[model samples]
Target: MGDPIKKIELKDGTTRYRFVIDIGRDPATGKRRQLTKTYDTKKEARAEYAKVKHQTDEGMFVGPDKTTVSAWLDTWLKSTTVDVEKATAANYADALLPVRERLGGKRLQDVTEEDVDELVSWMLTSGRKRGGKVGSGLSVRSVQLTLGRFRSSLNVAMRRRLVVRNVAQYTQIPREARRKAAAMAALRVPWSETEVRQFLASIRGHRLHAPVLLALIGMRPAEVCGLRWSAVDLDAGTLSVELTRTLVEGEVEEKGPKSEKGKRKLPLPKPLHAALRAFKARQATEAIRAGELYERSGFVLVDELGVAWKTDRFRRAIHKLMEQAKVRKVRPYDARHACLTYLATSGVPDVIVSAWAGHADLSFTKRVYIHPNVEHLRQAADQLDELLG
Candidate 1:
């Protein structure tokens, strides 16, 4: 009675829309029901209307509303019950918050594939700091992740009957090719025995020195920081990696080692063993004097205040040490790669090396090991012949 209903064909061949007359009683409220129903095509809309009219006569109808994509995303982010980790949720929120301007006003039900394409294209063409720098394009990787999250949000909306279709499902992101590493080694800067010595020489008497050396040997920073006195076996010349220290909101927090694989005993070289013994003696003397609980979590590493050292602070210290030593700066984690390369070229068995390093696969070790020096290869070949004989 208000206005005549009409069907409209969308540019996309697969769908059609219509504002149909509402004529049915609301099953729960006993009030009259009224609204629109969309269909796959114009022909299908007529069939759908016929079916809906019959259903309405018999009693079954629901109303649709004008919701925007950005509006629904906001609701989904705040209310969805997905079991995402804290760090992951923080990342999603950060990524989604800035894109509101791009999507906020667009009608969710009327969203087209072109809208998704244009938004992503604009993100990439725009700079790194989201409207900060003109020339710095967004990282392809971050853009890809943002798009994936968008798709996930849309999927939730579709499930709740908030959106008609998941338009983001069909969107695509262009790929960027891999880049090369500029380090001495592909993924590391394998310090020669001499370089290690020089590094130690520079950091002597420095608070973080011994732990840095221990890191170079094989232990991850977290594993080393988490080490407790109980985990140390001074006489046995080994250290048990039990806990890892992480920085949370600028404070050191101790947590169990990241994985079971991370909780292993590693034999310390003679120099490291001696250093730990010396470190213990010094720490014991200080603990007695300070009357403060000497952070006995036997961390092979700790800050000046006898508190656990954080991984990032430790990394920054390592870089500073590099600067002082005049060595090219390499990440502390690269020391793991350096150690693996040293073992591979030293004739250690691949399987044995894998277990020692807690690597899940031997192929991963092989792929990352440094290229052997020509002379070392010849030496290995000669040794192989002697062993074969």
Candidate 2:
């Protein structure tokens, strides 16, 4: 605290009020920090000074900031959030790259709604990178996720009184962008039942057949990679979902399931049970044959060396196998969608299907995971044909 207000004569002989207050020392550099304000009249300066005093008294005052968006994001990811997991923080750091590139240099308090609005437009147009291409527009979904995380980060800023409001709030994706997203989604069609059967036939008796089959049975790739031999009981014909191993920029990181429901026990189908038994025996034979080289990592998805498979490798392997089999190449996630769609179309109960997919919300499981092709809707079309006749 210092003098609340001081009247000073300007060069033009007019008067103004000024005040300076010691905020605190910068924790990073151990340098002193202060805030100085000049006002057109004593009354205004006194009012603002009182507000500052009240804030200080209430333990809500924030020091003057030289913090830019990038710096704040770095610090926030590292130190601000106590509950955020390392992988999630890594994702947040990644999602905010466009923000850092566009607005990182601006003072944290200086960013306005207009600036954020421009950022939204830029991200949806030519600000994103895709598939080795530079300056390609991001999908509308990607833009929405990036901005959603940005808005959450800005909420923390607001709580600290760094800004009076969230400058990044209330952003909406344009209709044109939404239409483009729909078109892109349509082009990424998942495999139909025939394609699924072809893929299964192609991967039959392969060393990684069991793990690949898990994906076709609605297991997330992370779940498949994370599975260990201990979680599977061939005698009981059950496989438990316990942990997940995911890739963070090419590094394998072990973590728990996404939710409580994600940790489930699924009864193995006869074919999958046989596949696992054969794979387990093969792995044992290889381990014994190459005793010194065997790592014995205990993971279900591993190479001959016993090292656990990460998602990227698994995804690529699946794609290669699809090409070799002459089957349409769809993402492993899309395979999970096809499986869920199959269950839904084949009269599986909605709750049971959701549980099998390790999802808490039945509607979400159906809406996001179930993808039906024209063949799947033939029954409805047939019924309509009869009705019209």
Candidate 3:
């Protein structure tokens, strides 16, 4: 009754049908427009034609655009404000780089589940080229994180109506990768209290003593580096972890803690209190020697010239300190682990330990930092026996 379907015979003797529908006038040009679709059968073409005609009559027909994944991602990155932290934005950008390199050229609307699956597979097996050679494939955790970033950006495209679905949601990290990730997580080892005490004693009188002591007190490395004299009260014996210093993309940035719990005031231990007092007195003497050349940065930890320590410099110093200590070598971050482990073993309540460590959740502290020693388990069994008796 409407425009008749045009049937054509192919060279292979199969037949095909073409359907055309009057969509509407081009608003800008004030001219009539049509949508054309081809199908293998007249029935198929007619079905599609009816759907399109209904959509056109209802004024809900939206023409597909030529937007590519890369273009959409670029736009989304520029426009997105949610979940973007100053200290972590660079890491998010870095995560998106591989997505752009792999799928940027593909049309946003045309990105299929197969394409997303292929991207995940490639990330698992092949590594991004660094210099002239291809580096090792990304770790399972890295792949999972990268895919998560891609999914988040694709969600933006869906919200903008650029794509009907986010294909990335269907793709998953392979089973092998998951097993490897689990194994790696299980291998994380925290230092013992004895090792921590030995390390602190060895690093005594070192320039990094203040930072190392702060780390041993369960302050994050960033929080330790960002500590300022104004936030410390020797009389009250409290230190406030209000700000953190981070290096993102090789640039130093000072910002508040990542979560509300991170902005907490913790009691200063007696040893740490004495150390800070001595350190401040020594800094004052150095400030006088440097005179006008001394940089008046109010940071609690500073070099002899009074400049605050950067993250990289602090990492190198910690590594060297571990070697000099000749104790079981562990990362500076393990200092927090050591402190958390001691507290957990010494019968400290999970809530208090989590607050003192600035952890947003107690489960994370229990799962990661609370390594139960054999002796502690034996003591727990003894307590259970005494209770039953």
Models, CA RMSD each = 7.2, 3.7, 3.7
lDDT of each: 0.69, 0.86, 0.83
lDDT measured at residue 214 in model 3 versus the true structure, 0 to 100: 95
- What C-alpha lDDT, on a 0 to 100 scale, does residue 257 get in candidate 3? 92
lDDT order, best first, reads 2, 3, 1
lDDT of 1: 0.69
lDDT of 1 by residue, 58-175 (tens): 5433245477767777778877536754444567876765356578787777777888888778777773664367556565666677888888988887665555577889877754
The pairs that clash in candidate 2 are none
TM-score of each: 0.68, 0.85, 0.86
* Tens digits of per-residue lDDT for model 2, 1-389: 45679889999999999998766666578898778999998889999888887777776776667789988787666664468777887777788889999999999988988888899899887976755467878878778888988898889887866766788887778888899899988888778888888888888988889888899899999999999999999999999999999987767789998789999999999989999999999999989988899998999999987888899899999999999999877888888888889999998999999999999898998888887778889989999999999
Candidate 1 C-alpha error for residue 283, in Å: 2.0
Compared with the true structure, model 2 gives a TM-score of: 0.85
Superposition error at 69 for model 2 (Å):
1.9
**Winner by TM-score:** 3
